[model samples]
Target: MSEETAARRQRPRTLRQRLQHFMRVRFWRMDIAADAWIAPTASLDRNWPRGIHVGENCVIDEWAIVLSHDYTRGLYRDTVIGPRSVIGTRAIVMPGVRIGADCRVEPGTVVSRDLVDGEHVAGHPARKVGSS
Candidate 1:
């Protein structure tokens, strides 16, 4: 067998070994606060903090991208997802956005600001569409 091939085979399994590899790779740096649930298929981007502070019982769905830094300007910030909140599939949470407890961010939503507790938001620039 070729030396290069043997070396490749001996390499450690990257955190991103699954179909949704980005999720696991990014999650390695996340804090993932107590009892928070993160789906295996979720795709968390690298423009996030070294650790994610997820409150208890938070459910981050598949393909959700939670960011803690603004890549455009090279500014870093922290993202806080409060307890019991649900982040829907493919939702994008921008840097420094604080999602309050029990909030619901719908699929395909782009959240760029703070969300109050129990708020139900949707759309590109997510707004308070209703109260949960």
Candidate 2:
């Protein structure tokens, strides 16, 4: 393995350490369990609520924000991304949005609504661009 990869693996684990690691790094937390793969640059904010579940073979791209709370109202909810879905780069998934299986959310889309299975959505408000 490369030196940087090896060094990161060897780093010690602690509560403070994990917090610092989460803040400093731009990836899924080590404790986050996923059957899918997440890209290194994908960021999940520290203030994000719990119960973030990603299904099998999902791809969350860089700079995509998946939120589990409505910060303006202080409401907590779960954000579910179904299996084989692709959340494009810089997409903003709002609180309580349930994305269905095999859906493709285009880049820069702000998804605040639940998507049906095998749908393709795009744009700021996120409409159905195509059917899969």
Candidate 3:
């Protein structure tokens, strides 16, 4: 592992962080990394909790929705958010989408397709706006 990553693992967690981790891991059964920060209001797919995979150092901001299942379409697929990425506030990640590392999803954007590494996207249908 990198020195920075090793150092991060050694840091102690606060009570709130521990509680959140417990709820996310034990209760929700999501594959969120130890150092990832998920906002209290972030909505990970509850119906298919095992399908949501969040990588190390990811930040899922408030009201962001990492949706892994679409009941209307009878779809259930994994939604992967790569490491060192940020899902902006209220961003909606569609089912089966694989977001790449170092990407930034702008707020209120609806991501319906896979993202390449270091890509930044915005808009309702999620067009590529830039790269990291």
Candidate 4:
């Protein structure tokens, strides 16, 4: 066995740490909070583990894409989806956007900027559509 692999196996681990490690290694780097659900058809960035954080009670629907890295300049930024937020089908949340709590992103929306709490948005460049 490789030395690094053997040493890693020999180290002790707490249950929580082990679980976190498993989740990071096995799933996409989206640090999804408990009770948050991402549909099976959704795609989240695996390249930047520390860049994605999804809060509790959030729902990311089918074919949604949550990106954290910009390939143009190879930039990395944190992306946050706050509690109780909903990202609808085919939505694309761009890198570095902070979506606040209780926000609703409509289908096929492209979120290119930050969204404040309680915002209901839609369209290509996701604009505020109605009162949240």
Candidate 5:
């Protein structure tokens, strides 16, 4: 990482900011980049929060859901949202899914599998619609 970027990351989180991300970053042990934006209404899998990773500059919009576990199958797997990606409003990302860097997941879409870098996906099972 660039020196400036590293320094920015090292900067302390303000009380308000800490409170906003407390559930995922502190109590849940999720790996969310300092610059990532997770909307207040977004839902993350509390069952396996440690398995969820949100990369730098990623945005998880309102009502988006990112899962790291499936209680029905008793599975706990890592789910990754790569750098600069955007999880659109109300989207659902299934367990163990890895969304690559710079990708875009459209609103209300359900992602059940991995995505390559720069892909733009939409629909129930997240079909590729475009790419960056």
Candidate 6:
């Protein structure tokens, strides 16, 4: 590999740098708190640019999508994710959903409502399973 590619493999970019790059390249408008871990495959809604807020120490796993606009409902609202939480692989956070801190959303979940602090949920429509 070339020297630049080798250096890139040796040291991964910081979360801030990654976020900035995504904002620049993908044109996604999101407010991601420091220490957050957003997978490169995670998709944030770009149609509603200013409608996503992620708190510190959150993890958005691969293929996870955080949406902000509901075309079917003809609505647009903010989607919030936590100070400390994990959005599992392929999980979908629907428009306007608020995910509280210390929560864990298991894989393949479809969240349609607000999740309170310390809540752990899974499955379609995301029922409260237990505390995190």
The 0-to-1 C-alpha lDDT of every candidate, in the order given, reads 0.73, 0.71, 0.87, 0.79, 0.85, 0.81
Please give the distance, in angstroms, between residue 85's alpha carbon in candidate 5 and its true position after superposition. 0.1
lDDT of 2 by residue, 1-132 (tens): 224323433444546545534543435432343334454666655565354666766767668887877778987777888877888889998878899988889899999999989999999899998976
Q: Candidate 2: give the clashing pairs.
A: none
Stretch of 10 with least lDDT, candidate 1: 1-10
Model 3 Cα lDDT, one tens digit per residue, 6-93: 4444556668777877887899898989888777778888899999999998877789999999999999999999998888899999
Each candidate's TM vs. the true structure? 0.74, 0.72, 0.86, 0.79, 0.86, 0.81
lDDT of 1 at 46: 59
- Misplaced by over 4 Å in model 5 are 1-17
Span of ten consecutive residues with least summed lDDT in model 4: 1-10
Candidate order by decreasing TM-score: 3, 5, 6, 4, 1, 2
- lDDT (Cα, tens digit) per residue for candidate 6, span 44-129: 88888689888876777779999999898899999999787888899999999999988889899999999999999999989888
Q: Which tens-of-lDDT digit does each residue in 80-109 have in candidate 5?
A: 999988888999999999999989899999
Cα-lDDT of candidate 6: 0.81
Poorly placed runs, candidate 2 (over 4 Å): 1-33
Location of the lowest summed lDDT over 10 successive residues in candidate 5: 1-10
| Steric clash count of candidate 2 | 0
Deviation from native of the Cα of residue 11 in model 4, angstroms: 38
Regions more than 4 Å wrong, model 3: 1-17
For model 2, state the Cα shift of residue 120 in Å.
0.2
